[model samples]
Target chain A: MHSIPGRRLIMGLFLIFLLLPIYWLVNMSFKTNAEIVSTMTLWPHTPTLQHYKRIFTDESWYSGYINSLEYVVLNTIISISVALPAAYAFSRYRFLGDKHLFFWLLSNRMAPAAVYALPFFNLYSAIGLFDTPWAVALAHCIFNVPLAVWILEGFVSGVPREIDETAFLDGYSFPRFFIKILVPLIASGIGVAAFFCFMFSWVELLLARTLTSVHAKPIAAIMTRTVSAAGMDWGLLAAAGVLTIIPGALVIWFVRNYIASGFALGRV
Target chain B: MDKTVNQKAWFLVLPVFLVVAFSAVLPLMTVVNYSMQDTFGNNQFFWNGVGWFKELLDPSTDLGGRFLASLGRNLFFSMVILAIEVPLGIVVALSMPRQGWTVAACLVILALPLLIPWNVVGTIWQIFGRPDIGLLGYVLNAIGIDYNYVSNEIDAWVTVIVMDVWHWTSLVALLCYAGLKSIPEAYYQAAQIDGASRWAVFKAIQLPKMNRVLLIAVLLRFMDSFMIYTEPFVVTGGGPGNSTTFVSIELVKIALGQFDLGKAAALSLVYNLIILIVCWIFYTVMTNAGVERKVQAESEPAAKPKSSAALKPATALKPKEGVA
Candidate 1:
C-alpha cells in the first residue's frame, strides 16, 4: 500500500520529463519567429497562425508531407502483402533453408541504414527509380518486410493448429480459406505490423533523405534544408515538427488496445 | 503448432526472397564493390583489394584512428543507452496500471516521441537545449549550470544520450508491458499464498516471464543505438569536437561529405560486421540459456512430436526466438 504512492510519483515524474520537450515544441510552433528568438516564455506570447499558414501555402513544404505519406503508405502496403504469405509459410510449414532464410531476413533489419544510403542512391538511380516514391518504398522493404513477417508469424503461430485443419476439412480452398478465415483471425497482428511499418518508414531519415532529391523529398529532409535557406526559422521549424508527429499519433490511436500486445509480438 | 514438411512451402517464401534480394542483396554487393576498388571522378575506378580495410582496421593511420575512436564512442553509447533504458523501461512497465482508459492514454503519449522523425527529435532538443531561446537551456542557465551543448564536449554527449533515452525507452517499456501482461493471474495468487515479498514475487515470477521479451528489447535497442546518426547529427553535427561522432556519421562524412567512396565503403562493411558480430554473440549466449523451450519441442520428429500442452500458452510462443 505504501508503494502505491511511490509508484505514482515515479510515473508522474517520468511522464513530465517525457512531455517537456514536446511541450516546448508545441508552444514555439504558435509564436512568431521574432518572438521565439528574441525572448523565452513558458508559452507562446503574441501567438499567431502564420507559421502553420506558411507550411500550408508553400508548395515545397506541403508537398514534402504528401510525399512522405505517399512513400510510407506504399511501403506499408508492400511490406504487409509480402510478409503475410512468408509469415504463413513460417508459421504453418517447414521447408529447406527456412531457418537460415528467417535469420538472413532478420539480419537485414539489423544492418545500419547509413551503410545503405550511398548504395541505395546509386542503385535507385541506375534503375530509374531515383527521386520517386517507389524507390523509397522498395528500399524500406529491406527493413520493414522482416519486421512485418516477424510480427505476423508470432501472431499466426499463437492460433492453434486445429483452426487451420478444421477449416480445410470444411472444404475451404487455401486461397479462400486464407482470405476469409486466417486473415480475420490475425487482423490484430496485421494492424500491429502495419503500424510498425508505418512508423519505421515514417521516422527514417538517412535512407529517405538520400534516395530522393526533389519530387519525393520528405518533410524531415525539407526541414533540414530550411535551416540554411532561411537562417533558422524557429517558429516554422517547430510547426513542421508538430505536423510530423500527427500521422503516428493517429495510427497509435486507432490501435491503442493492441499496442502492448503488438509489441509483445502478439502472443497474448 | 504442427508444421508439415512441404518443399512447396518455398513458393510462399519466394516473394519475400525476391523483394529482399532486390533491396538488400544488390546494395550489399555495391558496398562490396566500393570497398575493394579505388575510385576517382567521372565514374572511373581501379582495383585496390583490401587496402581500405587495412587502413581502417589499423589504429596508427588517420583513417584507422577516426574509425577506432568513433567505434569506441559508438560502443560506449550503446552501453549507456542499454544501461539506462532497460532498467527504466522495466520500472515504467511495472508501474503502469493494469486496465482502463488511462492505459490507452499512456500508450499514446509514450509513442509520440518515437513517432516523431529522428531529425525532428534532434531539432526539438537542439532548440530546447539552447541556453538563450530554448526551454531546457534557459532553465539550466537560470539555475546557474553552465550548459552549452555546442561548445562543450561533455554537454554534447549528455544531450545525445538523453535524447536517445527519451525517444526510445518507451519501446522497451511497451515490450516489457506486453510481457508482464501476458503472465497468468495464477502466478500472483500463488505468490500471495506463499507469503512472498514484493521483490521475491518479481524475481521469481515477473522477471522470468519477461525474459524472452527483454532479450528482444535489448537486441533491438543495441542494434539501433550502435547505428544512431540523425538525432546526434542534427543536435551537434557530431561536434564540440569529435566528442559524439558515431561510426555512421563518420562514414557519411568520408563517403558523402568528403566523396571518398572507397574508404567509406570499407568503413561501412567493417562497421556492419561489428554490429552483426556483437548481435550474434549476444543472441547465441541468450538462446543457449534455454530461451527456446519451444524449439526443443518443435525439433522432435513429426510422428511423435509432443509439446508441453499445459505450457502450450507459452509454446512456440518464441516465434521471434528461432534465431533469438
Candidate 2:
C-alpha cells in the first residue's frame, strides 16, 4: 500500500488536538478550586482527590450517575428488542407502506430533541410517568428505535435468506427461529445497536432534564445545577465531567474493532 | 438478495410502529395544537389560529426577527463545520496506519471525544478556553492576544465551532476509513502498472470508492450541526449577547425559559419542517445512488469475481445496500 507523506505527523497532531481539552479537564479536576481560579499551572501544584471524594460521598452527586445509567439501560433494552423484529421484517419481506413507514421512522430520528422537550414533559406528566426513569427511556425511543432498526437492518441483510428457510424446514416456529437460530447470527448487530442506544440516551440532557426534576436527574443535568447552585466549584464540576467520560470510554474500548463499521451504521 | 413479497411482515413491524407513534405522533399533535392557541397564566386558552405562524414568518415581529437571525446563523455554522471537517477527515483517514496495534490505539483515541457526553464536551472546552486559568486562553493571553469567549462574540463563535470540529470530525474520518478499507488491492496494483502518480491514484480510485460514505458523512454532520444545542449552550450559554444562539437554543429559551408556548410551537413546527424536507432530499439521492451502483455491479460480470472476493469480508460483516 502507498503511504501518504507526513502521515504520522498528521495523525499525531490531530490526536493531540483531540486530547488537549480533555487533558485540561483532568488537570483541573485534581487541583483545588482556589488554584484553578487564582493560578495557572501546567500540572496540579498540589494535586488532591477531594473532588472525587466529594462526588463519591454525596448522595445527590452519585445518584445522578445511577439515574443516568438506569434510563440508558432501559432505553437500550427497549430500543433493541423492538428494532430486531422490525429490522428482520424490513430486511426480508415486502409489506404495505414499507417504504413510507421506513421514511417516517427515519424522520423521527431527525426530529430535534428540543422540539419534543415541552410536549414530552406534558405528555409524561399526564400519563403519570413524570420524574421517572421510564419517561426518559420511552421518550428516547422516538430516536433510538429508528436508529437501531436502521443499523440492524444492514446487518440482517448481510445474512443469507436460506438460513430462515432452513430453520423453517426443520419445523422451527417463527419465534423459535428468531431466538434460537437467527438472533445468534446477528448478535454483533444487536450489540452495535444497543451501544448506540446507550450512547445517545446517556449523553442526552434536554429531554432527561425536562422530564425529571429531582428524582431521576441525570449526571449531566446535575453538573449544570451544581454550577448554578454552588457558584462554580470548578474542581467538583471537572471531576463530574471526567466521571461521565469513563463509561463511554470503556464501551469504546470494548467495541474498538467494530468502531469504524459501526460508525457507518454497518453500511460499509 | 431478492426478498419475498409477504404482507404478514407487518406483524413483525407492528411493535416498533406502535412505540414510535406513541412517542412521535402524540407530541406532534400537541405541538400543532399549541401553535394555534393563545394561552394565559391560568391555563385559559383562546383560538388564535395561524397568528403565531404569521408572526414567526414575518421578520418584522420580534419573534420572527429572532427566528430568522438564528436560522441564518445556524446555516452559516453548518456550512463552516462541513467545509472544515470533511476534507480534514478525508486527510486523517488517508493518513491512518494500515495494519498494526497502533491502528487499534489510534481508533480508540479518535473515538474518545465522540463518546463524551455533549455537555461534558462543553465543560471541557469551557474550562480549556477560560482566559484566567485555562490552558488555551491563558496561553493566548500570555502571548498577548485578546481572547475571552465570555465577552467577545467572535471568540465565542470560534470556540463553539472548534469544539464541534473536535467532537465530530472523527465520525467522518471513521466512515471514510471504512470506505477505503473496502477497496480491493488490485486497483492500486493496476495504477502502479500504469505508472500513476499518488494524486492520480487517489483521484481515480480512492475518491470514487469514498463517494457513498462521504455523502453519508456530509448528511449526518449537517443535520447534527444544524440541531446542535447542548455544547454551544453550555460553552457560551448563547451569550456574548445572543450572537452564538442557534435555532435550538432560541427555541428552548422561548419554550422552557419564557414559557411562550404558542410562539415556541410555531417555531418548532417550522424548524422540524425544514429538517424533514432536507432529510427527504438526502434519502432520495442516497437511494438513487444505491440503485445506480447496483445496476453497474450487475452489468459488469467480467470484473465481478475479483471485486467480490476482495469485498467478501466487509460484505459478510456488513452489506452496504441496506442504507435506504
Query: All candidates' TM-scores?
Result: 0.93, 0.96
Model 2: what TM-score?
A: 0.96
Worst 10 residues of 2 chain B by lDDT: B315-324
The clash count of every prediction, one per candidate, is 0, 0
Per-residue lDDT of model 1, residues B60-86, tens digit only: 999999999999999999999999999
Q: Which stretches of candidate 2 lie over 4 Å from their true place?
A: A228-230, B302-324
- On a 0 to 100 scale, what is the lDDT of residue B145 in model 1? 96
User: What residue pairs clash in candidate 2, if any at all?
Assistant: none
lDDT of every predicted structure (CA atoms)? 0.87, 0.91
For candidate 2, lDDT tens digit of each residue in A37-91?
8889889999999999999999999999999999999999999999999999999
Q: Please tell me which predicted candidate would have the highest lDDT against the true structure.
A: 2
Q: Put down candidate 1 lDDT per residue, A1-268, tens digits, no spaces.
A: 1122377777778899899999999999999888887888888769899999999999999999999999999999999999999999998898999878987888888999989999998999999999999999999999999999989998888778898889999999999989999999999899999999999999999999999999999999999756665588888899999999888899989988888888876653
Candidate 1 residues lying further than 4 Å off, grouped into runs, are: A1-5, A228-230, B282-291, B295-324
